[model samples]
Target: MSNMLSNGISGLNAAQVALSTVSNNIANAGTTGYSRQSVQQVESIAPSNGKYTIGSGVDVVGVQRAYSQYLTGALWSSNSSLQAATTASGLTTTLNSLLSNSGNLQSSLDTFYGGFSSVASSPGSSAARQALLGNASSLATVYNTLGQQLSQQRTQVNSQIGDAVASINTVSQQIATLNGQITVASINGTPNDLLDQRDTLVQQLTGLTGASAVTEGNGSISIYTSAGQTLVSGTQSYALSTKSNPYDPTTTDVVDSAGNDITSQLSGGSLGALINYRDTTLVAAQNQLGQSAVALADSVNQQQAQGLDLNGKQGQAIFSVGSPGVLPSSSNSSGGATVAASVTDVSQLTSSDYVLRYTGAGTGTNGWSLATTGGQSVSLTANADGSLSGAGLTFNTSGTAQVGDSYEIQPTRDAASTLAVSLTDPNGVAAAAALTATATKTNTGTGVAGAVSVTDANNANLLAGAKITFGAGNSYSITDGKGNTTSGTYAAGQPISADGWSLSLSGTPASGDSFSVAANTNGLNDSTNALALAGLADVGILNGGKTSIVQSYANLTTQIGTAGSQANADLTTQTSLYNQALGNQQSLSGVNLNEEAANLVKFQQAYQASAQVISTAQSIFSSLITAIQA
Candidate 1:
């Protein structure tokens, strides 16, 4: 009977334990990372017949909690991917906005170039030139503004990377601390709510650095990078730092104490995305812009040098000379040269009606005298056959010459060398009785020593049909009377013009050659026109280059998109897996409230019945004692 009562008490205890487990499961169902738990019951054993045993009554076995290692691992993995994708996508969208083709820098360049082209076609119109200049100024402003914006974006990314690293370190430390607490709690068989907190910390760490988690014995977990770098291990966390890349100081990257590219090592995270954008997409765009500038400068200079201007000037440079697109070299001794020319009176020069001449020293045995002492000179002469001599002396041919070099001339042995001259006053009519002069070599040698002089100056005759050729090739040619032909190469003198237009060569023309004329006359020499044209082409070409750069950016963004989608999908799948695992665990561990309540009623009835048995036993014993006493 005592055994029976004891057995009944055990059944009562088991019922209560079941109820507690069910209530606990219901209470924590909504809690994050809380796995539902339940109690297990088993029969107590009683010895019988010395060795054999029989069931006595129910006894509480053990309490189990719901958990699945696989599900938890999946959750951590997905969280990392999700974090990385979000970071990349957000930044790329901003970049795309900045680089968009429509209404962006590219459009600004188009307007600028269009304005220059309009000016080139109408060089005589001041309004057009002014408008072109305005557009050019605006274009420069646009370039500066765009460059600044790009720089700012890079800065922003760098700032974000710093913040992310800090956040990562904080979470890592938290997780490491939690790992210690969880290990102790699990060993003591205490509730592991702190472990759940630690898990949350790990998840947050994954978002920042794409860290993975590994469960250790006794409910402790260690975190590592996807590449297997230890992040958190047994209450110890390694730190991350944001530093400028040694190879490229313009950008920042993640590293440990020792510098290394941990960007690619990070599989998925915001920090990785930011690093990639700065080093690859942003830097390439800047380089492309620089390249476009160079290409524009070079091509325009080449074409402009080949065309003639309004002043009948040929081989004149249109752009500034000597590779204007390159950044100045540090070791260069000479300062950058400036080519400056201005028409004080616009009325005096028209785009189609201007003369360009180099004013410099003359070369040869008897160096020709310059029109102005101590300045460069280009002599102009006329030739017979109605062709002028020395017209070609105005162009540059061999190498680049600076502002103070001279060109010399020698006598030629051809009949075409006789000179003819023509005089034209402001009224724009050729003089009828222009004088012609016969040129004779006073001292002649094989170009090594030659002295030439002009004699028989019938001012009327010489000026009538006499012409001078500046150099070996006729750089300049003037037509003379009815059909008189005369030619003589230029010795030395200022470039004389029938029109009021004059040019100081600053440097010499080649012997027998004229200074190179730049076509598309904007008036400033040294291929300024070519520079303008090249600047226009640069607008188009650079826009194309930028398009390519943006495409690469898009490709990177697309990768982010794919990663983000996959991450989100994984998260969903992980949630499902976790829930299913929890359900299975709950089946073994969770307490059913309704079932527990029913058991409560049954156990109460059993306890009442056992009490009644004890009361009956007591009453029988008391009656027997009384009978014995009587």
Candidate 2:
């Protein structure tokens, strides 16, 4: 009876414990990060009475949590990828819409270029000229608006990056604290709740920085960044900091605890995605737009310079744009070294940023090396006056610079934002060429001169004009305004350029053939320049004359659209994968109320049976004591 009572008591204790465990699981079923738990039990043994060993009822040891390290790690990784894709997708979509939707660059460009026809058809009409100017102003406004919006997006993303860093710091500190608490609690019993809290914090941290975590032997987790920098270890956690970039102050950099820049290493989370999008796609798109603006303005201005306006005067610049920007790095020496850049050839320009580093002393390629942001090196040319020229730009360096000093050269980054129509008066639109060519009646054979295109607007005798006379063997002699003659043998289909103008001579010409080049007296009635300006819409003026201004802008729009589409698709796939991972992890660790309810009934029945056993043992002992007394 004593053995029976002891066994019953042990059974009762085990049953009660099992019921309590089920109740706890039911209570926390809706809790996030809660792991399902069960009471661990085993059969007990008692001292044997000579013959066979007697078995006790049961024993309650501990409660165990249903969790798997593999599942949880998979979930964390998927979440990080999902967050990165989400951020990148949003940014690219917004940029694509800005370039492709209605009221976009292409739409505004169409209206602007279409106005050229109106002005060309009626060069002297004030209404037509004013309409063209209106369109020009509208085009400039679009460029400015687009540039400003892109800058605003960058500012917003920068703020978001700062916010993410702060959140990461907070999460890391909490995780460190929990790690210590969990380690200490494990000495007494399983700290299931504390362990869940720590894992939740780790998940949050991973989303921000794509950090990885490892469980230690002492029941604590160690967290590390994607770049393998330690974020948390035991009770100690290192912090991350943000700093301004030396090359561009507006840009930001992520630094480790020891002040090492880790911006490039954080390539796995939402923060990384934002930084990449801002630096690559956003910057490239903005620069491409500026390239078109610069090329368009330069080409039109050059053509305008070679013509006369409605008042029959030399044409002035039609548009003004931002000049090349040269930024000395903040880390540059205090030697006051300065570099100023200007665009020298629009056709040779590219939508890329360059870094100019001083190496020693050589004028062109000798003293400095020029490389694009993508690490491509460009050949540099020596100029007479301590200037360097490359990639359609001329750089004038002054003052003193240390051997490692560098400057960020942006030839067209801000051009779009600063583009504007410089001429306010309708008569300022140059509509006719300054020089006209005519064939002399005495000429025989089929020889004719095409329209004149000016090579140098500032030529001393540009307006004074000249005369060309053909001789034997297709030879030609040019006489300038002062009657200074130069002889040259003409090449078939080649332009005979002199007095700052170029003209092509076609058809066979007999000896003694002559043509006179004189100033145009057509006034506002002449539409020669207007016709040329209108035809500029089809001329390849950018990218080494491989693409027109409008085509370049279109290419930019297409590239962004394609990138955005791909980003969105990636986000969709990542989201699906994340969902699957989360579901799998949850199925392994999540509590089910229905299951706990069944466990409650089972434990209740066991408790009742154990109580009955104890009662029976007490009654039998009482009866035996009574019998002995009788």
Candidate 3:
């Protein structure tokens, strides 16, 4: 009877313990990150004779939380990817809208070119010249505004990166603190709730930094970035920081606690996306814009120099473009070397920053090496003029360069922001060729002189003016502005080149009849150069003749649009995947209220049955004692 009572009490104890575990599950069914707990039941050791043994009541060994490492890891990875795609998509969308807008660079370019067309039609009209100036100003304003906005976007990216770093630090510290508590709790007993909380914190951290968590034997997790940088180990959490880039101070880099840059290795997270955009897309777009601005200004300025403006002087530069920027390396040792950069061919400019590193001194290519950010190296040879010029850029080395000294040359990064029209006067507009071809009154030829045009505008003789005299057989003799003469025989239907000007004589000319080429006294009405300038719109003069000015801008807009579109698509796809991952994780570990309700009722019945057994044991004991008394 005593053995039966003992077994009944043990059964009651085990059933009550199971009932409590079920109640706990039912109570915390709605809890986030909660896993369903199940009781591990085993039979107690039974008292035994030599031949046979009697089993004791059940014992509650442990309560295990339903968890899957694989599912949790999948969820974390998917969330990280989703966050990165979302961030990149948003940034690209904003940039795309700006670039593709009707009121942006394309419109400004059209208006600016239209101004030249107007001047070509009526070069002397004050209204038309003033309108051209207005358009020029508008074009400069557009470039400035675009450059400023791109800079602002970079600033926003920097701010976001800083915020992400702070968030990572906060979550990492929380995880480390929880790691200590979990280790302690594991030593004493199971702390399933704390484990779930720590996992939740780790998931948050992963979303921010794309970090991975490694489960330790003591129930603590150590976190690391995709680059394998240790973020947390045991109770110690290593925090990330941001530092200014040496080449561009406006940009910042992610660094470890020891100040080692780890930005390039970060991927699959919001922070990584922002940094990537700022470094690659944003910089490239800005440089492309600046390239267009520089090319436009240089092309217009060169053509303008070739013609005669209303003031009867040679045309001055219509726009002033910023020069190439050379910045010394921040890590350069004490050196006297100062590098000076200039744009030799704006048409050949590329949207890349070059690094010039000083080697041991020599006269030619041995003195220095040029490398692009993409790791392409060029061995440069010096020009005959003793200047180092290559890759569409010229670098003049002043003073002495230390062997390790380096300079970063940015050819057109700031050109757009610094572009402006320098020609303030309508009369400064170059609208005509410098010299005109005319027939002398004594000429005995039916040939009428065609309009004099500058064949080689950069020729020194074209500036002061030249003269062409007709001879027998439609031939001509040239006398340059410096009084140097060259006589050549000509055909009636063929063209003639004299003193940097080309003209064609169509009719027969008698001997000794003169056709003179001289400076245009009235150039305002001569729209020859204006027409040529207007033709720049249709010419393939930029990107080494691959595209026109407007085409270049169009290409920029198209690229931005394409990039944004791709990012959006990736975001949608990643979001769907993340949802599926989350759902799978939830299905495996989440508590179901209906299931818990059934468990509650079942455990309730179990508790009642155990109670009944206890009651029966007490009744039997009471009867036995009564029997004893009788």
Per-residue lDDT tens digits for candidate 3, residues 255-309, read 9988889988898789989888988899899888988888899888877876789
Give me the displacement of residue 370 in model 2, in angstroms: 0.5
Tens digits of per-residue lDDT for model 2 on 1-630? 888998889989999989988999999888877889889998886678899998977887789988889999998899889989999999998887776543577767777777767877887899988988888888888888888777778778888888888888889899999989998898999998898888788887878878889889888889889888898999988988888878877887888888998988887778888878888888898799899999989998988888998787878887899898888888889976788999998888999999998987755376888999778999898888868899999988888878899999988888888999998998888888888888999899698878878889878788887888988898889998998998899887888888788877788778999998988889578888887788788899987888988899889888888889999999999999999998999888988777888999999999999999999999999999999999
TM-scores vs. true structure, each candidate: 0.54, 0.95, 0.90
* Residue-level lDDT tens digits of model 1 in 384-459: 4322223122222233333333322211101011111121211111101111123224312122211111122112
| Candidate 2 segments whose C-alpha is farther than 4 A from its true place | 100-102, 362-364, 458-460, 471-474, 482-484, 621-630
Worst 10 residues of 3 by lDDT: 97-106
Structure candidate 3, residue pairs in collision: none
Q: How many pairs of residues collide in each model? A: 92, 0, 0
The alpha-carbon root-mean-square deviation between model 1 and the true structure, to one decimal in Å, is 18.9
Ranking, TM-score, top scorer first: 2, 3, 1
Whole-model lDDT, model 1: 0.47
Q: Rate the local accuracy (lDDT) of all candidates.
A: 0.47, 0.86, 0.83
- lDDT score, residue 313, model 1? 39
